[model samples]
Target: MKTRIFQLLPISAAVACLGFAGQANADQTVRIGHVAPLTGGIAHLGKDNENGARLAVEEINKKGLTINGQKVTLVLDAQDDAADPRQATQVAQKLVDDKVVAVVGHLNSGTTIPASKIYSDAGILQISPSATNPAYTEQGFKTAYRVVATDAQQGPALALYAANTVKAKSVAIVDDATAYGKGLADEFEKKAKSLGLKVLSHDATNDKAVDFRAILTKIKNERPDVIMYGGMDATGGPFAKQARQLALRAKILSGDGVCTEKLSDLAGDATDNVVCSQAGQALEKMPGGADFQKRYTARFNQPIQIYSPFTYDAVYIIVDAMKRANSTDPKKVVAAMPATDYKGVIGETTFDSKGDLKKPVISLYNYKSGKKALLDVVTM
Candidate 1:
């Protein structure tokens, strides 16, 4: 009788172990990749984007996730591309190899454009929170999508503001020579010309360039009414500062890349001479902007830079697709993205055939007393 009882105990123990194993198998971890320039001149902006995604991941996990009736945990696999195109591709490949279900970023157009191919090849959905280059979506990569308006929309808006609002008849164009900068400059130049604004001169400067005196001197000589700089704040700020120091009274107009809260510090008092366009609505105007700002500040102990709200929405958008697809598989998620109509912190987001926002908003900003002031919001 004792031997029979011991045999039954062993069988019961085996059944308990099988139950534990089955429960473990029912729980799955879904990896989502987020890439940005975490260690560079624009690292602050990159960190902001990453923090937004991280915050969303934490919130989603806390709320609990279930896909196909199985419990799931979301993990954010953040990577740094340093805003470099080459490094971005490398990071993209690594994420692909790591089998991330989807990706949230590659902030700069230069990096996003190059890295997008890798994501496309891997059949993973890639959403850019801040990359505004129109080419990012025009590449025919079904995997590429952006939460922000494209440069196509932003450039013309900036050009229209420069021509009508600033009352500028002539403008000089300068680009950082990267995919984002050059593309935006080109679009602005085309629209500026169509609007009957004379293009005084167009020049190219590398993204890493700090000394814009040579170019500014050349532009100053031309004496255009507005100096349109298509670059990030890292270069645009100093460019405006030097232009002011050189006594160039022309207002500096730029795209979303130069539109940030940190621009005030980088450009100092000269920020007043700058007018920039953002590819999204102003934070105050967003549906959940105020609450998001409060939560983001509390979590990161820092102010939102530019694209954090968009990044936050990007993560939610991805999860929304996953839920609709009822699968964490990248291919299934991509299939569900086209039907996305999720309302998030940034607002209602829907994609066109090209994966660009169906209805996009562009906001114009200027600095007054070293503070960013919203000038106008344009919808297209």
Candidate 2:
């Protein structure tokens, strides 16, 4: 009788283990997708943003969250949009088809703006860390939002600086023809003209173009006191280099798009004295920048870039929203977003009625020793 009981106990334990395994296989997990230009001209910046999102998931899941009375695991699904709007559509569709609970990004404003429509229709929440185009949220898409202030705000801030600080009387505008590029160029043009500055010339360039001898030559003749580039580093770098080669010699200014190490690589010595506006001041200057920077460097084995702090904050914002809504339902998560003052790595972040960041600060930087460092902090 004893021997028979022992053999039965072993079989019972095996059955219990199999049942647990089956339940685990059927367990529901919360998944989020991140879309970026992982393989193209902006791949490095994309990778930085993607890593930030992934780090957020890793830290959140390690805490072992429970939603709806069940254990929840946060999973990250990465997709490459190649910084193209058409490809952004493909990547966004893939995320929706995969049924992720939310999405963290489509980095560029051009890609983010179009892909947002798809996410809006599908009822998926998207929070962009770096897409600053005004039209991104102006379309009245309830599910689309960004953590950084728009180019509409930062563009004019730079224009004011050009007129008031630099005392410039003439300015030239250039754009790469993307949504982010054109919108900012327009804003600067409007404000620069209002400030009684002469508009030297406006020209368009393709993102793939590496040569800008023609554009620089035209600007040289016009002789603007300053040149404002509304484009990313890929073209901005070469334009800076070519401008120097052509002896245009105008002071160059760019937006957050050109705030990267790649600008130095592109322009080499020509990157000197160039200025741009990015989201926040150096980590050492912010209230908690020091601690966050330490952790980021320890984890990633490198210094943080422009959008990583925003992306890091984006993760916590979503997590906090999920907790507040008491659910991971996309609609509920979004509804809770604007009401919360999310204290993220960048500082206390709050959204306005338009789902845009309200009066967030912008920091100015110039190239020093081939790196971008804080010059001044501007409130916008």
Candidate 3:
């Protein structure tokens, strides 16, 4: 089957079509699919990412993008994968069937990894804003790309902080057992042991599990100085809350999954004990960070959450490839990704041979007064 440079508009673009009513009909509707868990426990973060992509699409459409001498209206074809691998592939297949030129997510690495194969087979471009698993881009798939630093980098930085700054002699680890969770925890564990921290225990939990009393009780008995969780905010938040209820004094440490604005609400008063790392610089520290935050809040009526800045930059990165190719075809845009060096809200955006961002920064953060506060930054 021959793919078109612009496919038929999907129902996801129905709202975008409404904006075309008063304006001249667009010469072509360029659809970009976005998939994330919009209906699950981490919906807030997923919705934030979607909103960022929507903001970029809306802005691009307003300015009217031109490619190959044709004015194109960018249409956002958003889908919900519920952060499940099975649903991720289904969503990926749907986007492929809809013939979108590219995709913006599958926020979880578990989802992103499986969905990437589908995109690769279809020759479509995929740029994840938050998926940090090194295996994602390591699968030798040209379609796989991520703007954030990988677990390989994030894990060592977090472990260094725990062993040096926090000065923890012993630590207990818990993971949700998903690809992202296990991979990150394993990396941390490896580095932590090398730093001479005693590994008290290692436990496993489910990503969907809210009650962590069993794991928390077991961890408490171990008397570790630090309790690190490898999972998203959904479970990580509740895990901290339950640990507090159990009177566990060990500080809670986690990777990017558990780091977000929503963690404070979910963890309640327990949020103060949590320290987490994000794969990039804090939004306020980015190049156009302040201005982007102002505009995002004005448009969304809320503060920016995790991945919004990266997703916003991801959209621009995709557009940059399109402009360089002078075409909206996924093949051409994908072929042009390697040569990209676009500057956007994030600092200089460039990718390595493996499709991972070059010169990525890891920003560690802690919550203070029910808000995420920057703790430190390490560039890799």
Provide the overall lDDT of each model, using Cα atoms, as 2-decimal numbers: 0.94, 0.85, 0.91
| TM-score for each candidate, following the candidate numbering | 0.95, 0.91, 0.92
Which candidate would rank higher by lDDT, 1 or 3?
Answer: 1
Reference-based TM-score, model 2: 0.91
- In the predicted model 1, the residue pairs found to clash are none
lDDT tens digits, residue span 1-380, model 3: 23442344455376677776535444888899999899988888899999999999989899889887778888899999999899999999999999999999979999999999999999999999999989999999988899999999999998999999889999999999999999999999999999999999989999999789987888888999998899999999899999999999988999998898889888998999999999998988999999988889999999888888888888889999999999898999999999989898888988899999889999999999879999999998
lDDT of 2 by residue, 102-171 (tens): 8989899999999999999998889999998889888988888788878877788788889888889999
Which candidate leads the pack in lDDT? 1
Using TM-score as the measure, name the better of candidate 1 and candidate 3: 1
What local lDDT score does residue 6 receive in model 2, on the 0 to 100 scale? 88
In candidate 3, residue 9 scores what lDDT?
Answer: 46
lDDT by residue for model 1 (1-380), tens: 99999889989999999998898668899999999999989999999999999999999999999998889899999999999989999999999999999999999999999999999999999999999999899999989999999989999999999888889999999999999999999999999999999998999998899999999999888989999999999998899999989999998999988899999898899998999999999999999999999999999999999999998999999999999999999999999999999999888999999999999999999999888899999998
Off by over 4 Å in 2: 1-27
Best by TM-score: 1
Ranking by TM-score: 1, 3, 2
**RMSD from true fold, candidate 3:** 8.6
In Å, residue 186's CA in model 1 sits off its true spot by 0.3
